[model samples]
Target: MAACAYCGTTILFGGIKDDDLRFCNDECFENGYALVIARSVSDNVVKREANKIYNGACPKCQGIGPVDVHVSHRVYSVLLYSSWSSIPNICCRSCGLKSQASNALFSLFCGWWGFPYGLIMTPIQIVRNIFGMARPPEEFAPSEKLENLVRIDLATQYIEEKSMPPPVNDV
Candidate 1:
């Protein structure tokens, strides 16, 4: 009933010889170990610059800044209500690539367990994030300095994506 740790193939206690570790063969062990290394690298690279990516000014362009849109679904969690689950990560209004990627990772991996409301809301929110990042590139102005620093050529239109919508003062 035991499965190989690397390939998930059935293995007997006598077949693999790693004591407590369950590897069917040497090849599978090597491959599974390689995957572990790759995942570690991805985690390190993404997490190392997390502060700047989530807090600092836009790395791609000069004008656009991050925002805290009320539409973010992360505001709710199963254990806590209202502001308990609200982790305010930076969101881009002009070009939302990095922010969307980060938020999508969080929603899909970390908060997908948000049931009831999240069951319906989580998918819709991810779609919205995708659309936010899919806006036309021409709508923004590209920055060469950012390209040199981050190696990503992102562009933007405005400093702030959300204006108070002309303040429905008359209404």
Candidate 2:
């Protein structure tokens, strides 16, 4: 059993191959190729610049930072329909805490009305929110996810550039 080089899914059937790399599908091939090119363009300089930008003032409160990313879950249910989502924020500690508190309350109030999933997910979401609130934000460093977000943003731009055709030398 071989695994796809791009998404790591086990290949149960014939898949596309590029030299030594195998992909599960065309979408994975395209995405993986773009990632390779993006990695080539995203050198240490790009990472450092991204780090500096990420450590700037928090987007929500404009407070002095090295902000961290906070994630909170919310669940809503009515009868047979239940939906849940995770809300993520990059902000200072105070802002993150505030958001978490509000989201926790929202989940507590509106998350237990559905048939089965609401009953199951409500407590889970509340517990997750509680755990998230317990983790204190870093004062002098960006969260790991924050750094990854910055890197991804830069990588996307680089991928776009690599995919574009070269300018024609029109004299």
Candidate 3:
């Protein structure tokens, strides 16, 4: 059995092959190609596409120039419970800053209730947010980080949309 190149699913029968890469289905082929294309494109093309996406409507506030930013926090309960999670905010810098502030505050208050891990992770999360806020994204251009994020996002969306089953109409 051959493993699929993109998703690593087992291939029990004949599968797709492009050169040495094999895929389980057409959807996988398309998804894999999407990622390959994103990675193989020149930096100039990538930057242009990234800037176009950044100029589009922001997913959160429907504004413009939204850059991808990740904000996470930690929460601890009593003695034995602790959790670390991120609040996903892919929006403008202002919105991301607000999200970072609130999540950091939440971590500061709630993340110190557990055991040793709570004490350790709380400060780390807070410091991370502080440093992240210190470096705001470019106002008129997308950074290299933002361009890579856009590429991944585009490939992910392509995979998601292609992998969904077609709707069946019941007459």
Candidate 4:
């Protein structure tokens, strides 16, 4: 029996892809694929960051000034192999500009897949493109407003309680 390349489990001769297969089953193959893709996405993100720091020039004003960028990946639990499982995006803090790294990445992958623009039409691909675009202040500032509101409310409550009369015992 050959060992599965991913899980290291023994592959039975009659089970799934037979004993000669590298993976024991489709699940193992897909899990391995996800790991590979996720790693690829992370590597791409690192490259992008390095480029932004070392080579990314402003396309609009052509001024390289305080360009803040962040990259992250999301895994689609239900997607199959090559089903838009990993996504990455870039944001420029200087000009508040954001762009989908995944779209370009996906486009490249689709080209490799021999599909014409297949990456853009995928739901996850579309989402990946849209997500990085200039988001609202709240989108990035998760609790800015909430924190201010809580502070105000606490101040108001303190004032009201301080102004109230002491409790009187009922005979």
Q: Considering every candidate listed, which one attains the maximal TM-score?
A: 2
Model 2 misplacement above 4 A: 1-43, 161-171
Q: Candidate 3 lDDT, tens digit per residue, 62-136?
A: 776566554545454566676777565567887788888888898898888777778888888888788778877
Pairs of colliding residues, candidate 1: 140-156
After the best TM-score superposition of candidate 2, give how far the Cα of residue 136 lies from its true spot, in angstroms: 1.7
Candidate 2: deviation at residue 159, Å?
3.1
Local accuracy of candidate 2 as per-residue lDDT tens digits, 72-111: 8999997778999988787777787888888889989899
Model 3, residue 48: C-alpha shift (Å): 2.8
Query: Model 3: residues >4 Å from true position, as ranges?
Result: 1-38, 41-45, 64-78, 86-88, 161-171
At residue 162, candidate 1 shows an lDDT of 24
Please give the CA lDDT of all the candidate structures. Answer: 0.45, 0.75, 0.72, 0.41
Give residue 111's lDDT in candidate 4 (0 to 100): 26
Tens digits of per-residue lDDT for model 1, 35-143? 4333323322333234344345654455445322222334234542222132222334554566565676566655545556556656766676666556523223322
lDDT of 4 by residue, 1-171 (tens): 677767988877633553444777888875544443333233333333344443445443556533333332232222232334432222234343333544535444452332332333454454544564444333333223333333333334434465421222211
Question: Among these predicted structures, which one has the highest lDDT?
Answer: 2
Candidates 3 and 4, the one with greater TM-score = 3
Model 4 clash pairs are 68-93
Candidate 4 residues lying further than 4 Å off, grouped into runs, are 1-62, 70-121, 136-171
* Model 4: lDDT to the true structure: 0.41
